[model samples]
Target: MKSWGLLLVAALALSGSYAVDRNNFKTCDQSGFCKRLRGFKPEKSEYSLNLDTVLVHGNVLSAEVDTVDTTAQERKVLWHYAMRLSALVDGTFRVEIDEVDPLYPRYRTQLALDGEPKADGLKLLSNENGKLTLMNSQGHKVVIRATPLKIEFLNKAGDVAVVLNDNAQLVVEPLRVKKERIDDEDGNAVEVVSPLLCLYCFCDWILKCRQVFVFSALTAT
Candidate 1:
């Protein structure tokens, strides 16, 4: 009887594993955010950091991030974001970016970290010529550029080990209520934008993983 029960359990497990169908999953092209990010290929970065808005509070450095819309004849600010950089203990760094005032709350993962990571001391090395440099006690350096906001991590040898937003592929989709399309008198679809409800930041698990990878690369060098 025991042998027969074991065999039945093994059969059920195998059947469950085979029930999963890979084709049911959506591909990157089918996803809106993934498609937008992967398809974006511009000569230069559309996003820029507002140097005048840079602020330093305690161990954190933040600035206003803006993106330009050149689709129209005249360029204009298409979206706004808030970027925060922090020097954490053990010579690690953290970079975060989110919409400034989103129309709706974006999804943010909370189980990524065990708890709040301790911050380390950051010494301002230089702030000029559209660049800001900071250093930690362990001789690690963090460089921030003004135009086309970029962050570079350098080791004691002054060699850049990791960089963020180097390809200008950083994208943040604005969260809004999904509304149905309506036809107007001219038989054209009229777009309707939902009202401003609330605002929040988004920190995904993928971003946290990237942060860990960067820290590992920086430390390995």
Candidate 2:
């Protein structure tokens, strides 16, 4: 009975009889974050790993990443992130980044992996001047560049195997409170009305006025 029920469900699913709301879906262009990141074309990355905060523990090397704000008079930190580089088993390197202190908890998918990843113990080769090098159990080197914030994996022969953030498109939109408009002179809260909303309000007022005028005309008769 259970097998028959399972087959029936599978057949219904494969038949594509389910009602899907396509209007709820959005493309990359429709999403603000996606469009902003996709349109960004920077000569070099504005984010860098703060070498002063680099810490190595067991098989993980973690550091604080700061986005440089050049809009101000002098260089300043705009946003901060906690980055972790783990040298997993079989020469696979895993990079994880998250907001240092977020307003809301961000969802991270743990279902992609079958189980917790096993990391190999990292052997620190050099940590000086803006570069940190570590070797994994498989003799692969992980080079961390601090100035522009780049991670490179090199094989035993010193050939570059993989590189991260090479295109300089690393952007982390920090979670912040939505700023409300305010009256500058009075220092009171101001409501922001969109064009569409204004149009709707005007149409509603006109509709009510027309109804009142029609009622008055009828009463005058």
Candidate 3:
């Protein structure tokens, strides 16, 4: 998930003084979703945009999100999703993606942003290629790459700051309800890989590691 990159950038930007317990973190491959995502080859992204679902409201834009496939072909149930991108006047940008109407409510991140983004330095510009681009006079840009579904954030120097599908790894977890019947476990197991869950796993590992390290240090002293 892009949150991994955001966490790194936030740590670097806010305060680089804290010591990190790298051992507490799993290599991306350890994550089930990460593993599946990386398993997708370089140019083979399963996701595609539905242009007819596009909506533009002032500084905000949104569209439907979709993905392909299932084996044993008779079963038919398409995952539903929606994506929203907003450019606040404050030169900042935000992206929200979730299931359009979930059978079960999914986890929405509790991480609070620093209030409403200031309404400056932000420009909503559409390109000839139809990808929406948000430019910041202060040097930040968010590019919505529709095909194969990638979203890239660029720094003022034009280097990638954070990317959602950098390795074709932007997998979405749609909201699903637990089945009371037998034989659905396999299907369920493969479906609910939430990005919020990944963020939780990452954060929990960091906090627990930090606490343990601090306790051990104090006891040793």
What is the C-alpha local distance difference test score of candidate 2?
A: 0.66
List candidate 3 segments past 4 Å from native. 1-45, 70-77, 89-91, 107-123, 136-139, 180-221
lDDT of 1 at 53: 84
lDDT per residue, candidate 1, 14-35, as tens digits?
A: 9999999979999997765566
**lDDT against true structure, model 3:** 0.54
lDDT of each: 0.70, 0.66, 0.54
lDDT of 2 by residue, 1-221 (tens): 99999999999897775566668889898865666567654543377899889888999888999877655678888778888777777557767766787665654545555887776888889989899998877778888888677777787777776666665555555554544476867787786643221101111112221111111101111
Best by TM-score: 1
Which has the better lDDT: candidate 1, or candidate 3?
A: 1
User: Each model's TM-score?
Assistant: 0.67, 0.63, 0.51
Local accuracy of candidate 3 as per-residue lDDT tens digits, 167-203: 5544555543333333354655343333232311111
Provide the lDDT at 79 for model 1. 84
Ten contiguous residues minimizing lDDT sum, candidate 1: 197-206
Predicted model with the maximum lDDT: 1
